[model samples]
Target: MRVLIWILLILALAIGVSLLVGNNEGYVLIVRPPYRLELSLNLLLILVVLAFASLHLLLRFIHYARDLPANVRAYKENRRIRLGHASLLEALHALSQGRYQIAQKSASKALDLGEDPSLTALIAARASHKLKQKGQRDYYLAEAERLAPDAEVARLLLQAELLLDDRLYSQALDVLQQIEKIEHRFIPALRLELKVQLRLNNWEQVLVLLQQLEKHDGMESWQAREIRLQAHQHLIERHGHNLNTLMNYWKRVPAEDKLNTRIAKLAADAFIRLNAGNQAQEVLEMSLTREWDSELAAKLGDCASTNPQKQLQQAEHWLLSHEQDAKLLLALGKMCMRLELWGKAQSYLEASISVQPCAEAHLTLARLLDNRGETDAANRHYRLSVQACEDNK
Candidate 1:
């Protein structure tokens, strides 16, 4: 349809030109300095039109010729950019599929073609690391850093994460601390720093870093508890023999966290180490009231006081609520034996064995039986204790 329209328009133009030119009966005269010329108007008009057309064609050719180099350069640049983009996509795909060597080649190609050279170099670094080409990976990382000095934070973070993955916790910590100094409490960096501190047994720093993480929602509540538990256990093991230092550390912990079972046990044991029986009793009792733990009950039983009967009564009170808790029975048995309540000690210890046959409970019962001069029964329990300890080992 477009072709037929163009043909009709061309035919109309031809007919109109023919009528106008065929009836022309005019003349043209041109006088230059050297000569005068005269011609028919139709010829003159056709010659003038042809001259203008020729001039337009010549000027157009000159314009195109002048711009040729620029246009070619632009075309080459566009093609290079396209190739780089395609190479980048291919590299990412290969990296995802664990084709490290292919990814490394493509990333280098992208860098050579000038596609965000710094980022591509980092990609090459990652690919090299995946291929276990440590030298190549280090070269690419250094090249990336050189190409984009403004990307120091990103470069450092990646290096730190890589160190962390390699279990080079001290090295990772060094990098992360520098980032922390500059970036100031970046959440991801803080998380990494916490792990590093924990790995290095920096208990005080672990607590500090965890608080920082908690402030930024970098650590969950349960996760904070778990990490804190590990930190507190370590601190307790280190300072438990020093009464003043242990108390100072315990006081620094928040009251709500003091009820944590593991921490409470640690505090109680530390207090027991310093012969602070009442204080140890208080820590254990405080934790038990908040959350019932059988293990804590057993530890509570070990807190000896001058008045054993009173302590026994206090432990026995828990039995009203936790009737069949074996650890509670063991705790009661231990206290009863301490007070020399022979029959009651015997009953609680045997009941503990029925509920949960623990080696420690068996040994305690065996000693109580020995005190009662029941040699054969005591021997049986002593043998059971040895078997249980071996099984546990």
Candidate 2:
């Protein structure tokens, strides 16, 4: 339909032109002193239109010719970019597959092709590290640092993680600390720092890291508890001989944490070591009242309070609730013996043996009997204690 309309329009324009030419006596005249030139008006109009079209085409050709070298360069650059992208993908794949040498080569090519050189440099660094090419790894890492100074934190994090994997704990710890200085709230850095501290046996630092990690909910309750327990145990050992420091540290520990059976036992033992038996008794009694623990009750027997009657009463009271608990009976027996209540001591010790038959109860009973001039019975109890010990082993 368009072709038909154009053909009709052309015929109409031809007739119009013809009519105009026949009806007009228009002409173009160029005159000089010795020459004159003339052309029909229609011809001049056609020539003017043709001259403008030719000029536009000539300028277009000249423009293309002038830009030919630049255009070729752009095309080559585009090709290189495409190749670089492919190389990057290939490098990533090889790295994942553990083909370190191939990954490094491809990543290097990607960088040379200018495919986000900074990123490619980092990839190459990882590949080099995996290949155990320390020199190459350092070189690539340096290049990455130079190419993108803004990514210093990221590079440092990678460096720290790599050191951690290699078990270079001290180096990793230094890097991790650097990360903490740079971005205090970064979760990954906090997590890594905790691991490094633990490995280095920096118990105090581990405890500090654990507190920070808890704010982020970085660990499960059980995991946090386990780590906290380990840190406390180590710190307790460090202050073992220094009674003042150990008690001071325990005072600072959260009250709720004091309820943990192991920590409570540790504190009680430390108090006993310092001859602060009353203090030891207080810690053990507080924990036992909150929750019954056989181990803590056994540790309860070790507290050497000045008033044996009071300690005995406390054990007997616990027995009312935790009836048939052999450790409590053993503790009550020991407290009675301290006060020279031989009959009650003998009865409690015998009852403890009937309940649990542990070596401690047997040994305590033997000592009570020996002190009361019942040598034969004491010897029998002593033999029983030795037998129990062997049986346990």
Q: Pick by TM-score: which candidate is best?
A: 1
* Position 380, candidate 2: lDDT: 95
Q: Show the colliding residue pairs in model 1.
A: none
Worst 10 residues of 1 by lDDT: 305-314
On lDDT, the candidate that comes out on top is 1
Q: What is the lDDT of residue 129 in candidate 2?
A: 91
| lDDT of candidate 2 over 292-374, digit per residue (tens) | 99989987778889877788788888889887889888888888877888899889889989988988888899998898899
On residues 38-123, what C-alpha lDDT tens digit does candidate 1 reach at each position?
Answer: 99999998999999999999999999999999999999999999999999999999989999999999999999898886678888
TM-score of 2: 0.77
lDDT of 1 at 79: 100
Alpha-carbon lDDT, every model: 0.88, 0.87
Error of 1 at 147 (Å): 2.7
RMSD of 1: 3.9
